[model samples]
Target: MRKELYVYHEGKPVQAVIRTYTERDFDGLIEVQRVSFPPPFPEELWWSKEQLTEHVVRFPEGALCAEVNGVLIGSMTGLIVSDEAVEEAHSWSAITDDGYIRNHDSTGHTLYVVDICVVPEFRKTGIGKWLMQTMYETVVQLKLNRLLGGGRMPGYHLHAGEATPEEYLERVLRGEWNDPVISFLLRCGRVPVGISEQYLEDEQSLNYAVLMEWRNPFNSSSL
Candidate 1:
């Protein structure tokens, strides 16, 4: 069954219906990805509507989409990679010269966040947070303890040895990195573990992605 999600900002409610992806939704998802990313992946890489429907039918929980007014504004897809699967892949690599898969499994689960994207015009309005919160809720419901993915943090190092924090704030306000989103995640207790040195090549930019584990304050075990 498909789930529904909603988020409110300053008393104005925004509806985000969470459901399995369809072919029609792929186009909108592609548009969102293109606008949100630099050197967007080729459109040909995306599955068609029929292919999306077929894939979802086979793996319903692996695909999810968020739509507002029947239009997809954002989406996220993930899979739980098990340690056994990782080991099997490694064994096969010995027969062939393929690269080894780095499988980091904790609590018997490794969440692979394939992608998460939000449209530009509707950004900074809590849509991204809502989508993530919804994802977390779903994870918890499935009895998972951790969520892993890449997120953008402020480019504080860009002004290395030159600008102060105040100057960095100015650059941030001028539509630099999405600082508020990073702040929200930090406030939610997400911690940074590492970064990708060459996450982006076209813009000569790198992504400071961190692996954040969800901690429940009220749970004694979590503390």
Candidate 2:
């Protein structure tokens, strides 16, 4: 699928194309991660050629990237997973097969999003939402039960001294607090199913993650 979007870059609107990434886009994808997640975010967590290759070969439809003038600026990756994987508390590495996504189940009922990133400059340009909308369409087209993703509590570390992760989550749910990642997911129409400990190595989240899910409205089973 291909979509054309007018996104703001440097205060000027530029056309961007969203499409399923190919093997040739690996370098661009890697570059996006490098710029999107920096410092505290581990460099080792960036996408690798092997992982990108596996994504294209195993589930190309779930791997998408946005480009402007042939330069990639954002990407979102997902792998099909069974309900059992969604029900259980699994770390990012486990569900995504340590980034290789070898555990992708073609018969699975859920589309488990692994990662999403937009370069700092291009953020808030509606690129992320457009990417998510594309995946939502994929879920409906494939008749998947829901869209699931683990969200980091990037703002939790700041409130760690005042509240435990659980308490912080409650506050966020109650609208008394806003967590960068969790709040973003909530705004995207996902609800928190639960929390996963050590879901990722994110320092800002204190290694904790919120299980975010957006059920497919057209799927009765999802309801």
Q: Per-residue CA lDDT of candidate 2, range 119-174, in tens?
A: 98888787887788889999998999999989899999999999988899999999
Q: What local distance difference test score does each model get? A: 0.52, 0.90
Lowest-sum lDDT 10-residue window in model 1 = 92-101
Off by over 4 Å in 2: 9-12
C-alpha lDDT (0 to 100) for residue 145 of candidate 2: 92
Runs in model 1 lying further than 4 Å from the true structure: 1-11, 38-59, 83-108, 154-157, 160-181, 187-189, 196-208, 215-223
Candidate 2, residue 163: Cα displacement in angstroms equals: 1.5
lDDT of 1 by residue, 110-137 (tens): 4445555677766666676666666666
The per-residue C-alpha lDDT of model 1 at residue 217 equals 36
